[model samples]
Target: MANTREIKNRIESVQQTRKITNAMYLIASTKLRKARNDLANTRPYFDALRGEIKRVFRTAGDVDSPYFYPPDNNTPLEGTYGCLVITADKGLAGVYNQNVIKEAEKLLAQHPDTKLYVVGEYGRRYFDQHRIPIEHSFLYTAQNPTLDRAREISALLLDGFLTGTLKEIFVVYTDMESSLLSEAKSTRLLPFHRMQFTPPAKEKAVQEPFEFYPSVGAVLNSMIPSYVSGFLYSALLDSFCSEQNARMTAMDAANQNAEELLSALRLQYNRVRQAAITQEITEISAGAAAQRRTFGSEG
Candidate 1:
């Protein structure tokens, strides 16, 4: 049992911690909403971009480009693979960063010759501490994901792929399925497969032909980079939203735990206080009775 003063101090400490956690919860909520809105605002353009790519594939008829290809079953897997890993700059977001790092590790284990391009400080530090080499780290982009930042990242990756520096590129990030559910996922970014652009069976309909400016390949070359940028932007938004949601959930749980601890501490404080009061009263009564006996003897 702690003394009353110690218990009081403990209660105050917990109260302060609760305040911090509550504030963090509110901040995370705001961030989550903003990220979702950004996603909504940008989704239509990307959706249209994707639709246009599909249309080009449908109308262009077996276009020969470096970007579009089917995987060769006979080709041996050689050359450095590029992995773009997204993680939070700071943690307290439950297992959000852990899940993403784990996913990246899984990718690395399968493809040992990977060149890591990390997006967050957390991921960069983790890989550095583990002695794993990172080819690049995009600092300050995880927390502030913008269109320009996405474009910059995509441009670097596209350059690497086009220059034959990287054979394949993949992005590891978290996808927010709902407010309560988020899952880490890895998606291949390069060597766009024709089947990936194909619409679903239900959505397939008659297509209209589109005339290219100079040639179909030339037009596709221009469009593919922007389309890849859009894809990267969407992934960043998703990962940010998931990180914020995870933080909100973690803070909410901390707040609840703090409340429970405060409740128990208050109850214990009251019990200790009552016991001290009772002991004081007993001591005073005994002293008063002794004084009365002394006076009677004197009389």
Candidate 2:
């Protein structure tokens, strides 16, 4: 049992800690809400870009577009794949970073020869711990993500895909479903999937040929990269929001625990002080009684 003095000091410390944790939790909760709204607003644009490119691929060229179709099956086994792993720069969220790292590890194991690209410090640390060779990595993405960062990352992946250095490129990240739920997702970024979106069965391409200002190929080249940018941006946004939510959730738990500890300490402090006072009172009363008896007997 700790002395009242020591326990009192501990109670004060925990109170201070609780205050800080509460503040952090509130801030994180607010940020998570905002991030979700931001991502939702841009989802339509991303969808439109994706739909436009896929539709273009269906009718773009007389010959098959190289980007639309799969290349030789043997190429993937022989060609290196670039994996972009997204994880928190710092981790406090429950299992968010861990889940992403696990998924990335599984993806990496599928390819014996791969060019690993690490995006954040956490992911980089994970690969280093596993002794996986990282061919390229970026460590400077802002705590609050930006579109330019996504563009740069997308461009790098596109370059690898075009150069034949990487037959496939994938982004492994956490997809934010909500404050409490974020799922790890591994998605292939290139070569772009050609999904054909056609008009209604009653309508035909000949009935209403969509006009391309330059050409479908040219239009697709621009839109596809934009679509990629949006996807990567969404991942980063999801991760940032998830990190905040996790931190907030953890801090809230810590704060509650601290409050409980403080309550226990206060109760003990009061009991100990009351016991000391009662003991002093009993001793004084007994001493006075003994003096009264001694004096009376002597007289």
Candidate 3:
């Protein structure tokens, strides 16, 4: 007994929604491919940096580099540690945003009350909803992501650690092994192993002690910051690509769900309309038989 006008209106509305979801799906797919390729291209650069770090550690002298500090328990844990959680700005993938949000939640659960550094608008909103504190936020657009901007953010995080404002720094980001496989991981940003500085367990003769032009400490001073910045930037890029891939997958699933829903609704609408028509025909036939009997009796 549904109104015909209401059914028509609903169908039109669903059709419009279907169009929008379809368009978004297409857009996400295109962006996903671009991001995936971009991330792949950036890998060699990261590998080169890794090689440079290994090489630098090999030649470093007796002087203790700031980057090579050991995590001492007795160092007196003062001040708070902040976590940087990187997630995508938009949501459409099935459970993509939810899974990341859950990861953030778990991170927060470990720390009684830790501040959040978020890279996406969606993450900020999620923190706000959960009563989590957000210390800093950076939102990026799809068209352009600047390395300088990423470096600036990384510098802030490192400065906080250096100045004792933030006791320790941890970054939670999605690692993109492949388009199909993405994982959220947390890693300490600083205090790399000095012992293992000279690449791991390959029987090459240890080179002679490294000589510094200015000072080894001074060289460490410059390179440590760059190393931190470069590594963070690379991680962010990987997460960025993962975000796009996650979104693309999510949107694809959403588009499919929407299509399935439309199909179901359409079927329901047809069945209801057909039943309504059949009932009308039954009423008409009944009325005609009743009229014929009345007419024959009158005659």
Q: Model-by-model lDDT, in order?
A: 0.90, 0.77, 0.71
Q: What is the TM-score of each candidate against the true structure?
A: 0.95, 0.86, 0.81
Q: Per-residue CA lDDT of candidate 3, range 94-177, in tens?
A: 565566677777867776556688887778888888777789887664234456866887788878877777776778877778
Query: Listing every candidate in turn, what is its Cα RMSD in Å to the true structure after a full C-alpha superposition?
Result: 1.8, 3.0, 3.4
Query: Model 2 TM-score?
Result: 0.86
Q: What is the lDDT of residue 181 in candidate 1?
A: 85
Better of 2 and 3 by TM-score: 2
Worst 10 residues of 2 by lDDT: 68-77
Where model 3 places Cα greater than 4 Å from the true spot, the runs are 60-63, 71-79, 108-115, 129-131, 139-144, 195-197, 206-211, 290-299
Error of 2 at 70 (Å): 3.1
- Per-residue lDDT tens digits of candidate 1, residues 199-290? 66676554665778899889888999999999899899999999999999999999999999999999999999999999999999999999
Candidate ranking under TM-score, highest first, comes to 1, 2, 3
